[model samples]
Target: MEGIDAQRLEVKKERAPKLPVHIAKEVTKGRLLKHVEISEKSVLPTALDMYREKVDENLKGEIKTHDTSKLRHAEVVEKNVLPTSVDIAREKVPTLIVNFDTEKLKHVDPVVKIALPSVNDVVREQEEFKAGANEKGGMIHN
Candidate 1:
């Protein structure tokens, strides 16, 4: 019998690995210096001096003697404005109820029923987990 001829195996080609992206260094100090230079050049020194003078004049005018007696009288008036009877009446008044459509009421039902776990629930679960772990003598994985 003639010897069978063997076929040459073809090699599979692979995609090349992607190269890392290059980022340029940020200009921090240079940008800050440029901003400062622009602000200095944009404003006139004389105008800035005039502004400072006006601000000082305004500040001087604003400093005046406050009448403590008048302030005390005003505070007394404000404190005494509310009557005890009015407060009692306000407390006795029931809250006003606004009725809405049945469909709107139904929409609010699920939002109200979403059973948000309370503080007690969270504490109870945590204690249960700790107790279970202690009993097993190992940390709970889940």
Candidate 2:
């Protein structure tokens, strides 16, 4: 094209897709931007956060790590907190026993509507399902 002017000769550069113009913003949209200092620092994505999120989401309560807190200036008790079964068996050292008065309860035998089978039956079942009764292998063949 010989008649084309200098202005026409210059190719128009396409605007870099205009970042796909986001119209609808979230409720917490500009709130995060207020906290971030764009000039001073480069803010990372929300996926890379400080808090370690629990992936498993345990239904049961949190597992206790430290049983007892290490007190700096707290009064330490010299006495044993918990007693062993042997200590419980012996009545020599009298301990604090909080017992509820069951005087209101009638001294009547509780009738079992559904009685569970005895431990003996469970043991018999275990014996039947023994891994190596015949000394064959860890697992029973039949």
Candidate 3:
């Protein structure tokens, strides 16, 4: 043992009662009898699951009772269904039609045509105005 090198020593591992290759492979892959978490809640059936028909009947009864109560409350407050004074006033107030036809607008009167003074004409007028201002001791507008 002292003379044998640890790295050179061979260790043999064996499984007693040899398993079939397919089953061994499945066991190795964790696909055979896999582990599962079991709880009481998960194992037991819920009220709805165990008594679906009874639960459905109970739910329908509750819904009918709720609807009847709502109807009775609505009947008590039925007068509020009528429009208020403000609502009546708003309805009476006129609303102008805002929709317009582009075709109708195209056929409308042409925009007022005004001739704009040419650039040269405007320059000439400004030159004459400046000369007049100079002649008037720069008090033309004053």
Candidate 4:
């Protein structure tokens, strides 16, 4: 310690442990600096701005009151429009007389008796017509 000069005293720095020769050889080489470029202007980190909108509301109302009063009125009128004389009219009508000869009318029959064909009779007549038409060789639509 006495042989060492004061100005020649050396200071030592702490270092991590050394890696094995095989691991050191396996490490890949990299570039010292990246290829990206930066501008002169810089941005600061700040909170975003909050915006608020204002709304206007309006209210209106109306009130009404009424007063009523009664009023009285009177009016009179006079006129001379009567006639001096008046005439009456009378009419005569003759009476009507009818004589009924029911005795002669009872002997004459106004309504004659008529017989209508029943369903069976009508069907039989249609069948006969069809047979006659077929014998006459005339074409009849169904």
Best by lDDT: 3
Positional deviation of residue 19's Cα in model 2 after best superposition, in angstroms: 21
Lowest lDDT sum, 10 consecutive residues, model 4, at: 53-62
Ranking by lDDT: 3, 1, 2, 4
Count clashing residue pairs per candidate.
0, 0, 0, 0
Model 4: clashing residue pairs? none
Q: How big is the positional error of residue 116 in model 4, measured in Å on the Cα after superposition?
A: 0.9
The Cα error of candidate 1 at residue 33, in Å, is: 90
Candidate 2 on 1-142: residue-level lDDT in tens? 6556644545322422333334324322665444555576778646534333343334223444433556367788798679878877686444423354567678888787987889999888878768446465566655
Candidate 3 residues 1-142, lDDT tens each? 6435543443222425678998878877885676889876546777778699788889999887784544543345445588899998787656423444455545567699899999999999988998988988886652
Once model 4 is optimally superposed onto the true structure by TM-score, how far is the C-alpha of residue 19 displaced, in angstroms?
A: 99
Q: Write the per-residue lDDT of candidate 4 for residues 1-142, one digit (tens) a residue.
A: 5546533443211243567776655543334434678769877544432111111111111112222233356576788785534321111112211344456554665898899999999999999999999999999998
lDDT, each prediction: 0.60, 0.56, 0.72, 0.54
lDDT string, candidate 1, 1-142, tens digits: 1232222211111233334433112342354334444344565579889999999988877665544455543344445565699787676666323333455454444455577899999999999999988898987665
Off by over 4 Å in 4: 1-113
Estimated TM-score for each candidate: 0.21, 0.18, 0.21, 0.22
Off by over 4 Å in 3: 1-111, 139-142
